[model samples]
Each structure stands twice: as structure tokens, then as C-alpha cells.
Target: MTQYWYNVRTHQVEEDAMSDWTQLIGPYPTREEAEQALEKVKERNKSWDPNDTDGDGWADHD
Candidate 1:
């Protein structure tokens, strides 16, 4: 019962943290497959800018 998590803010694949905010995107059997899916999501949302200092773009919410 492997699980995968994605950071929507950074659009990066994260190891299973199982937190309240980790956002479970998939429950794949293999880590490779989970990473692949994460890559696809990144591709679709290529404009993700996680470090916009001006606050006009994605903000680092923690």
C-alpha cells in the first residue's frame, strides 16, 4: 500500500509524509510510477513559479 504525495506549491514530488496537507495525488504501487505522474503534472503546469518574491505569483505557504 504505497502512497505518493505532491507539493502543489512547488510542483515537486515528495516522499510519503502522510500529513494533513500533503495532498495525496496518487497511491501507486511503485515509487517510479508516482514520480512519473508527478512529472506529467509538472509538464501540464509548466508556469509554476514557486519563488516569486514580488508576491505576484505563487507564495510559499507553510
Candidate 2:
């Protein structure tokens, strides 16, 4: 299947890794998801925030 990538340097969604890997975000399943890459990153960063003092990207204690 074809893949999509989010180009960080150009802030564009590409059909594939047209640029360097260091400048790309993903092999997202769809263009829509690739387009929203930054938002997804923001959400993830929030989840992993150091000050979270909670889950912080770690497994939760049951």
C-alpha cells in the first residue's frame, strides 16, 4: 500500500518520503492523518509531558 509522510521542514504532506528521514514524521495510513501530523504530535507531547507526574508515556499502575 502507498504511504504518506509529513515533511517537517516544508510543512507539507507528501506521497512518500520525498525528503530526508530526519525531516519526516511518518508512514501514516492516510493523507488526512498525515496532514494532521503536528496536532497528533502535540497530543502525544502532552501525554508525555515531564510535568505530567502521572502516566507520562509509562504504564499505569493498576
Candidate 3:
């Protein structure tokens, strides 16, 4: 079975195992929706750093 993964922080979509654990920012079925959701998350969290020294490279809300 194929699964989809979406990053609430970056709104990046992919086919991976972690998709199940990821928070569904929206019921979005399209890439644009996911992108919009990611933007919303970014806007809500101003301190989020998309580029960090961490290996994950995920933006964190401080």
C-alpha cells in the first residue's frame, strides 16, 4: 500500500512511514493545500527556523 506524508512545519509532502504520525494540518488532498497549511503553520509560529543546524533540518517554533 502507498502512504502519503505531509510536514506540518514545512508543508512538504512525500511517501514515507512517518506520514501516519504527522499532524494533519488540513483535509487537503492537493499539494497546494498542503503548501498553504505549511504557510499557516509558519505564520502562526514566528520563531520557527526553517534552517537549523540539526540534521532533521525541520523548522522549530521557539
How many Å off is the CA of 43 in candidate 2?
0.4
Residues 1-62, candidate 2, lDDT per residue (tens digit)?
A: 88999999999999868899999999999999999998887678667666544634433444
Candidate achieving higher TM-score, 2 or 3 = 2
Q: Please report, as a residue range, the 10-residue window in candidate 3 with the lowest summed lDDT.
A: 52-61
- At residue 35, candidate 1 shows an lDDT of 62
lDDT of each: 0.58, 0.83, 0.53
Tens-digit lDDT track for model 3 on 2-55? 444466555576554355554555545665555566555555554455454352
Candidate 1 global lDDT: 0.58
Q: Give candidate 3 regions above 4 Å deviation.
A: 1-5, 8-11, 14-18, 46-62
For candidate 3, what is the TM-score? Answer: 0.34
Assess candidate 1 and give its TM-score to the true structure. Answer: 0.36
- Listed per candidate, the RMSD to the true structure in angstroms reads 7.3, 6.5, 8.1
Q: TM-scores, in order shown?
A: 0.36, 0.76, 0.34
Q: List where candidate 2 sits over 4 angstroms from the true fold.
A: 51-62
